[model samples]
Target: MTLIEIMLVLGLIAMLSIGSLQGWREHQQRARLEQQAQMLRIYLSGLQAQSYQYNLSHLLWTIVGKSGCVGSGIKPADCASAGDSLFKPTAPDITVGVYSEKTMGFYGLRNMAQAGHITLTNAAGTIRVILSARGRIRLCSEGKSIAGMAVC
Candidate 1:
């Protein structure tokens, strides 16, 4: 074939490959995030089932920065970013966050939100479990909740 035709064919192939790869990566990320969210949900659900309080309005979950994963309970070193969003952290607050409510059936993607980088929202009104200093996690949110699930 002509050189021009060959070049055109290669270009098209490259473009298609790149696009497919990008889409695949995003899909993987979404699945990973969803898996992490589900894990946190199970944990919080267990807590609710084993809790003594009827409403669980007192239990709170601490958030640990991705940097050091301290102060929050789970050590930063243990947060596996591959399967858990809590394992991911930007910076500044190598270990920053406020306490959250996880009792009474409140759970969500742990540590999926940041200050400057906003977008952490739970619509299902479920729980928003944040990562702990020791790498553990629990449900918590800053806004008013409706006693449901933290729909992210």
Candidate 2:
């Protein structure tokens, strides 16, 4: 093959590889966000189960940012927030938001309380994991909705 032809083929291959790498990176980021959201949901459900087993009324799941250890410690003390007596230990960089009803009571399995949501966000996108008080978990994208689904 001519030198020019060889160079052209190499350039095309490089372009294709770059494109593939970009696509793969995007997919990996999306998967990470989904996994983070799912992890938060699991922690929230576990907290609820603990509340039920212990019959504690003041237990709450709080979302701690990178700066604060507050509710994410062994005991829900030394935190800045007032109602955040419970927190899930998460990575230092991730921002997970937890939502629950504002009341003092143990959340039993049969309570059927208002739905709670956990939001996981990154540079790529955001994923919201919805947890019903009745222990139903659903996944939804932020600011987008489908038929018979909730948007966060």
Candidate 3:
């Protein structure tokens, strides 16, 4: 083939390769988000189960934003705004993970901050939930799943 024709074919191939790489990167990021969201779901279910089993009235009350939580009156509900006493071991910990530039939100609400003791956070492809205000866990993305989740 002519040198010009060979050069043209090589350039087209290079363009295709670049496009494929970009697409793959995006897919990987979405996959990470999905994993995070799933983690969050599992955490929430567990916390709900725990409180329900123990019949912890105060902790359960705090979940849906009612009074009677361990330190709601004495302290603000915002996780970052709380004091040491609010974070005491006796208190049910409802904390989401932290995020900054590495995080993005669904509907621009990536950080759910604190609600009772269920915390939600997202860093772009990563999201987590910290329950009983104890350990940190990941949140699953709201999307269709090949794992037989019929809804997002």
List the candidate numbers ranked by TM-score, top first.
Answer: 2, 1, 3
lDDT of 2 by residue, 1-113 (tens): 99999999999999999999998877676666666666665665665566567654324444445433323223444455434444433444446554545521235545443
Ranking by lDDT: 2, 1, 3
* TM-scores for the candidates: 0.44, 0.66, 0.42
TM-score of candidate 2 relative to the true fold? 0.66
lDDT by residue for model 3 (66-103), tens: 11222223335654455442322112222233323222
True-vs-predicted CA distance for residue 118, candidate 1, Å: 14
Task: State which candidate has the highest lDDT.
Answer: 2
**Tens digits of lDDT, candidate 1, 47-144:** 43433234332232333433322112223434443234232333222233334343212223331222111112222222345544322444443344
What's the lDDT for candidate 1? 0.39
Between candidates 1 and 2, the TM-score winner: 2
**RMSD each, Å:** 11.2, 5.2, 12.7
Worst 10 residues of 3 by lDDT: 61-70
Q: Which parts of model 3 have CA positions greater than 4 angstroms off? A: 57-152
Residue 121 error for model 3, in Å?
7.3
State model 2's lDDT. Answer: 0.56
